[model samples]
Target: MNNFTIYLATLLCLLASKVVGQETFETRAKNIAAKIETITKEEKSALKEEVEAVNNQLEKGSITLEQAENKKKVLAEARAINIEARVGKEQENLKNLVQEKVDGKISESDTIKKSNQLILKWEKGDKKHIAKNEKRTTSQFVFAAGLNNLVTDGKIEDSDFRFLGSHFYELGLTYNSRLAQNSNFLHAKYGLSLMYNNLRPTDNQNFVINGEQTNLETNPIHLKDSRFRNVYLVAPVHLEFDFSGSETKGNKRYFKTHQNVRLGIGGYAGFHLKSKQVLKFDDSNLEATEKSKGDFNTSTFIYGLSSYIGYKETSLYVKYDLNSLFKNNTINQNNISVGIRFDLN
Candidate 1:
């Protein structure tokens, strides 16, 4: 309760604070040391114990063989990875501390040398860089060319040229690739086929007499006498796949062999040029002007599904036109064809 007692109490309080502060720093330093030791030993020991647990469960029939194997592998890898990351962070912190203290009193001349060496080490330490050096691109483009066939048959109005033949020379382009988790690259390709037909179409009356359906060849007639010489075009789009294997496999890792089956579904659109029609029996020798349904029914924009599969340099392709070939009341045609393709990419 006196001034001397108060002064003595204040001095003791200040001395106690100084002693506590030093002990607190010492406690923090001990904690850091303990953390480092645990990371270096105890954590790894615990992970190993977890792995042993999985192995024990495996031996006891509590887990399937595959499950045990997966568990062991995943556990080991994850533990290693997590521990490595923690170790890396600690190492980085240590390096930063060392660098600060070492550079604090060192001459500036050694800065560039140390910095360059550190960068070199970092680059070499990167796992991604190592993986990238050995990994390949997982995508590719395809090109194909082949003989194409076009066959669409339907009844003509009031006449009989019931059958006609049309053919096309084909050209194609494709782009394909794979995503992670799946080996096969999803593919898309398109083709253009130009056809030239030299056959003429005729329609005649078939009279049923005496309970017999007979072609009245005796009286021949022509309703629309049309000949298409060089005027049919086809364009097809498809999405397909190569099922042989993933890029992490035999040829994809070696000779880059594209040996697999690829099937696609898409649509096709086209145009018909140079159409002709003859309208009379006596006009058999007469060639009437071809009226290209160019008005409203001329061009066919058919979009249907297509697919294919093949291997190596050869692949199969199928295309169907969903859109009607003709705008007329008559179902002129939706196309279908199967053919081989060649890869150019």
Candidate 2:
């Protein structure tokens, strides 16, 4: 099987196990209650340390997605086992004490009071544990693909643009942090991304850069393909508003990879990594290819404003660069792109 199929199979198995096992949670929790009571405080601390270590590995990208998911399963199972054990032990103790009260070893009033206190204690502990687990933010790698184009200052005819041939793509890692301590509606997302943008001119034209001047020149010969590409290594930060009641806790790590009806607005700044032009044509009936790489007189830096709005993994994305495409070029063509964004958080 392919890697994707294998991963899917493993994930299905894990999820199935959780579902099948969930039905026995009450029984298992009762059975393990005594064992949980026997666990020392130091042992509980050790468990926390182990979970923290796994989280560190995940954040550092040292573990694969499957590995991270498996680790999370292990941690959850440990917590469940601990919770069930404690509840079971408490129930057993309560039963024993009630039996004593029935035998007249304790006063009826005293027995009632003690039983109520025990029940309250269990509820409080369970609530605290559940609250702790719900507040964590999960981190993962993301890959996005989309189309791109340029928005110029002066009038550029639509016929002079090649939208399909000009493609824009990005790959990056993102961390989502809850804006409010108790609410997941607002979030702050920050990450480093490598963005590639290709611009293809229409009407058999190619980019020509001389010193600080950059312009599109029509080819003397018939051209099969003529493309200019710019690459950027940027750090982006966004403020996201999720109206799906998706709660995120900055202090804890939880795995909820996608959101419905989410909107994000952000800006990015980065250095221009490289720029190149490629030309392909038929020379004397023989296919020929030429690639030229240089300073290109393109801007050394790039900054842009970007936004996205969508449901689930796919979203409409728009980005507009504030800076000019070329540093000192005669024509001012700012890079602007509108396309679909796939976010695998």
Candidate 3:
């Protein structure tokens, strides 16, 4: 080969070697940082296990409280010493990397600077590791209120229906089970709720169910109050999605407290706990109230489709019953409700 061609090939080989050396140095720096983290985590875990063992011994009456306390102090001091020793060793390893300079292909100053930057990056990642390990299934309490009504295929001719007093309230405790081990994007949400649904007919009217048929009946006296009430104990289950990102505050830790958008779609099945009606009238300068409690031809089993769309704490809630409001009723009326829901997490 010509002398110029040989020189060009040699230049390319040198350039490739330099690139590989730089990559190797960076990789080794990351490995060292990762090893240091793993060793420290293992040591902390051992210390926790030691403390737990001491507690177990004390609980079993094998050691007195004072002795257990002393043992805990000893274990803590030992852990501190272990950590100090490991940290010193890590520093020594880094110093050796700076001194050796990886076969002198890279300068010692450049190696130290690059290694320091890599170590800082890995240190920041430690918080992410901790968050991943700590994250798990969680739960929160919820409250909801809205307007409710019975929509039917048949209609009552002489009654004027209104939505003012036809309100519903629900209180529940909900739990979220994560679908993936290290993710909170998709979760299985389930909860137990107590629901109260009320409907008031306009123009002094009361609900009356005759045998298997249900309808609203008008009253002759000027009725001051008339309403129908039903209570339910339900278990709701849904698939909930959280569209929120993690943020770091003043501290270098990541938190997921701000869920900006959330959606839950699911169904619920419940049992009718009770059904009642109240009536009041003024007669001959006397005011009297009467209450009736019975099945009222209402369905005992309740199942429905429920959903909510939320931004932050407040959400619009909706529920539609699949079955008729009253069992074996001719009118075939179903209940529907819409309202707002709040999450207290």
Candidate 4:
């Protein structure tokens, strides 16, 4: 017989023999191997057993030869069905076990495969096409500066906003230095900034309450004749993240100049360094300045949350001072900035 036909016949015939013999799993596998002679030998044994039983019955005159042959055929078919069902059950159970492993719904430690050990051994034995993942590290530094808008909540009034450079201005610089890890593409950094601001009441008062210096205005300054301004410095340390595994992207690291908005709220302390007044109308500058000190207290101290947003290289962001500038200070100039911020990595 051709090999394909012979192999198929052996598979079917071996199943019948295996069931007849009540063989264990290991022995059945060995007997049903690719050796054609070994497989046919088991089939032959199964036929022999039937022939002896039939002959014994014939001698006793219980049945004819034809009856004996038909009985053997029926027994072989039943044996084949039993073995096929057993094999199918075993295969289905194995498939279920594999699926349970992938889902992680399986909690039993005994079921886990020791696949990592095998992988390690194989990689070590054949030193080809294998690499280990390591902690990343680096130190070449870079940095950038930018401006943002300012908004504030006041002690006496509700709230207001101003774009950078108009009633307000900001300057910031960031430094990305290397960590001590000694791996590739990994590090840390420190950031710093200085801000200036000017905020005034929307309406000027006809009468003034000189609380600080004792010079309230009468015919006080015209509503248009009042102005306010102040300045501060801030510093922050930002833990940076990066993706520069390949070449051709340039070595300049990533600078937060444009795109991608960043919202970060940390602790900050600002000292009111400068305070001044600009005359709005024809009156004494000292008198109007004294009456219009709404949100801006003389050298007010503030602490609170800060946040920002950016697009590619350009950004728009705002900060909310947590503390009041006035004793009744509600919220003051929030330092909303929109300037280029570069990175050093």
Please name the candidate that would achieve the greatest lDDT relative to the true structure. 3
Worst 10 residues of 4 by lDDT: 134-143
RMSD of 3: 25.2
Off by over 4 Å in 1: 1-164, 188-226, 229-236, 246-257, 268-296, 330-332
lDDT of 4 by residue, 175-264 (tens): 444443432233354443445555544434232334542221434445445445555545554443333332222322222211233333
The CA lDDT at 203 in model 1 is 41
How do the residues 1-345 of candidate 2 rate in per-residue lDDT, one tens digit apiece?
Answer: 432233233223223323322223222333333233344233446656887888899889999878975675465445535643553454464455334433656444654555566457655655664554465453434345566777777444573568787777665556777767666678888776667788888888998766669888898988888988887767788898876564344444443334468899999997675678999986677588889976588776789899999886567888878899899977688887777765543
How accurate locally is residue 269 in candidate 1, as Cα lDDT from 0 to 100? Answer: 59
How far is 299's C-alpha from truth in model 3 (Å)?
A: 0.5
TM-score of each: 0.37, 0.59, 0.58, 0.38
| Alpha-carbon shift of residue 41 in model 4 (angstroms) | 96
lDDT per residue for candidate 1 within 1-345, as digits (tens), equals 432233233223222322322333223323433444456355457766997899899889999989986676566446545654674554454344334433554333454455555458655665553444234332222323233233345332333333323222333233343433333455445544333323333344322122222122322435343333233444565555556553343222422325655565666555443333222333657544433221123333335565656765456765554554444524354434455544433
Q: Which stretches of candidate 4 lie over 4 Å from their true place?
A: 1-166, 178-189, 205-219, 223-225, 240-267, 282-296, 311-313, 328-345
TM-score of 3: 0.58
**Range of the 10 consecutive residues with the lowest summed lDDT in candidate 1:** 206-215
* Cα lDDT listed for each candidate: 0.43, 0.64, 0.69, 0.40
Clash count per candidate: 18, 7, 0, 43
Question: Please, what are the lDDT tens digits per residue for candidate 3 over residues 208-319?
Answer: 7777777787887778888888877678998888776455545543435226798999999976766889988876765889899866878877999999988865689999
- In model 4, the Cα lDDT at residue 294 comes to 31
